[model samples]
Target: MRRSAPAPQLAKAGLEVLGEGVADELPSYEQAFKAVVNVEVAPRATVARSAPGASAEADRLWLEHARTAAVIDDEGCFLIRGAGRDWVRVRRTAHTALSAALVPGAGSMVIAMSPDGRRLCALTEEDDDYWIVVHRFEDRP
Candidate 1:
């Protein structure tokens, strides 16, 4: 059987992930992404206790896996969810222009996305270590 990746604790260290996964009439990645960020995937039945009186509630969160899509190109990025889940496509737009251009250096990773399906992607470059550039496309009327 395939092994599932361990649960990942949420951390906003320095990662800016971007991408799009929808078209004119589909449930796109941009939509899902808006609600998901610095996401923490927890394991089912895994007990986690916070402060006192945190309440002993049943955990509905399961350790699904956490990963950001690679910046494949200027057109889009790809994300693979749970098994059998269709590949999510993060489309790009003009907002991407600002994103791909802003990191600290050419080697820093840049992530861009729009609340709308305008532009969403992460531009990755290798600096001595690694840095993140973030941008989100805004659809102006």
Candidate 2:
């Protein structure tokens, strides 16, 4: 399979998981759940305009957001929610496993495997249809 080059510009956009963030330590199931549950989207993202001719091309948008951000404390972890379709995504690297962070489901949750097991991601309902895009997850330092 072919993969896109790692994005260096994402850091400027505040893509924390993709940049500035380091590999975080593994967390217990309980810790992961708490972190995910505690943090919410807080606010929604405004729609972005497409380049002149791409208006009809369709684009992805953030429909809703969890109120709190992913919480990280002295504890191990806090977020691990089951996907709706009996499928929960887990990412594993040669040395560790990473659980799915965000779950965006319209019909059902999509569970995908990371080629390197270093990251796991999900799609939001913004597609109008069930579309998914996942990325690697790096542990926070």
Candidate 3:
């Protein structure tokens, strides 16, 4: 009988197949998330809250309270998303480029990059339930 390889190894191989010029060296999830702190969030106007009965003051406060992190993939492109929003893509090689903010909903986001740096994922908790969101680098234009 043939034995299957470990999950981690299989994942790495899959990434290599999908990644764009991905290197053999891949950072672990822990390391990837830790590196997220290094990516900076550009200053922007305060975001407004769309919830019913939410006041402008509440929206301003929520924007201020929102936390953000960025995960740099193996290709040097980074994915950034804040609480209750979709991921934003930015390239390290580019300067003066701005990423648009996405629709929001997930609270207190935690990010992780796939081994080949081809995917960005976020884990969030709401009402004692956890959710995962994934964004593929190749899918972006």
Candidate 4:
């Protein structure tokens, strides 16, 4: 049998968790990331929530991507309906807050989307490192 060393305690605590039923139709981060064909890292660190420039950044992302793609926010993941004229929150098994890693001084989430609106992803800073969580839409929203 091949045995691997146990993960470090701090690493375990810093892990980004995509909790069960982020949305009934949304697959786990692992499964979605596995099927991803492309990735684009943000050019700079994302602004922290409630911090200066944060709202601007959010607006830019929302206008650029959320208009065509599904969105994942503090409330959980959901899709904009009817050509972005309306919205529908995805149903989840439990109410959960979608957050990044829980490390001190960690920057806010940086988001990226596919032009085709088939994928959305977020990068969370973890101390000096970063963790990327991806969500792939099997069909265009």
Candidate 5:
């Protein structure tokens, strides 16, 4: 029997997780905002472009396959959308005052956040497997 080679780790996108309790430190408001924006929005265009008349089931399937994440800001929460490596779109909800911010190559299923709203923990994928990824407002450059 032959064994398969180990999957390669993706490049560090500067949003790598530091560890538990790292989120205790608070980030500046600007930094927090930027982190919230740095996520991908769900790719609705693919379904629209490929099948204008796609059924409800198709929509559900697309969402199931696409990678997703979320982050919170002073205004509200943001939904991040992606496929595997990076985010592509961000959607803002639960707030009327804040507007949506766009950032390329940032997406995952954000599962946790720091009490100070600086650090974020998300579930992302690498080579078809899901893994937890931590992101912080301070990590943004």
Candidate 6:
């Protein structure tokens, strides 16, 4: 199997990456559930273009403290749609994984921020697999 390259850093966009690895390496379901539970839930605030499938439980938790973002699109595209106008799409590196783990029946790219607004986690789909990328917001002087 061919390993994909590391994802691009999102620091310039105010998100500092803490750590990211394949979700399959996690040891237990309890840990994965804990990570996904921390993310804040809200009703749809912006218009979405496409609806990607949901994520799997095992792939949801990559880090305990790291914030996760999910992007669901039919074309397996990862996008950051903010304010219902600005659209920032990530270039896919790994296969998009839309397991039935987190957010069942969710569509479009999933972007979630940490409660304190200091961190972010992003999920993207590519080549029939889902990819998870995480970052924290850097403080400016």
- Give the top-scoring candidate (lDDT): 4
Summing lDDT over every window of 10 consecutive residues in candidate 1, give the lowest-scoring window.
Answer: 58-67
Model 1, 1-141: lDDT tens per residue? 122221121011222233233334423434434423334412112222332321122111110111132223434333322112222333333232322233334433223333333333433333232223232334423
Residue-level lDDT of model 2, residues 29-57, one tens digit each, is 24332322233422133222234422122
Candidate 3 segments exceeding 4 Å error = 1-106, 139-141
TM-score of each: 0.22, 0.23, 0.23, 0.30, 0.23, 0.30
Point out the worst 10-residue segment of candidate 6 by lDDT: 41-50
Candidate 1 TM-score over all chains jointly: 0.22
Q: How do the residues 1-141 of candidate 4 rate in per-residue lDDT, one tens digit apiece?
A: 111221222122222332222233433334433443235533223445555654445344433343344444444343312111212233222422223213336454433333333666554554343344455566657
Q: Report lDDT per candidate.
A: 0.28, 0.26, 0.34, 0.37, 0.31, 0.33
Question: Candidate 3's residue-wise lDDT over 1-141, tens digit each?
Answer: 111222221221111222233333443344444433233422123223344533333323322222222244445454333122322233333221111111235334345454345555444333332333444445322
Lowest lDDT 10-residue stretch of candidate 3: 94-103
Better of 1 and 4 by lDDT: 4
RMSD of 2: 13.5
Ranking according to lDDT, highest score first? 4, 3, 6, 5, 1, 2
lDDT of 6 by residue, 1-141 (tens): 112222333322332222322222222223322333345532212112133422432233422213223322233233332332223333332543323222323422344444333444544433333445455445511
Clashing pairs in 3: 84-104, 84-105, 84-106, 85-104
Q: Candidate 5, residue 108: CA error in Å?
A: 6.5
lDDT of 5 by residue, 1-141 (tens): 111221122112212222223222345333433443445422222222134443233323322322232344333332222233222222222221110111113432233343344455443322222333445454543
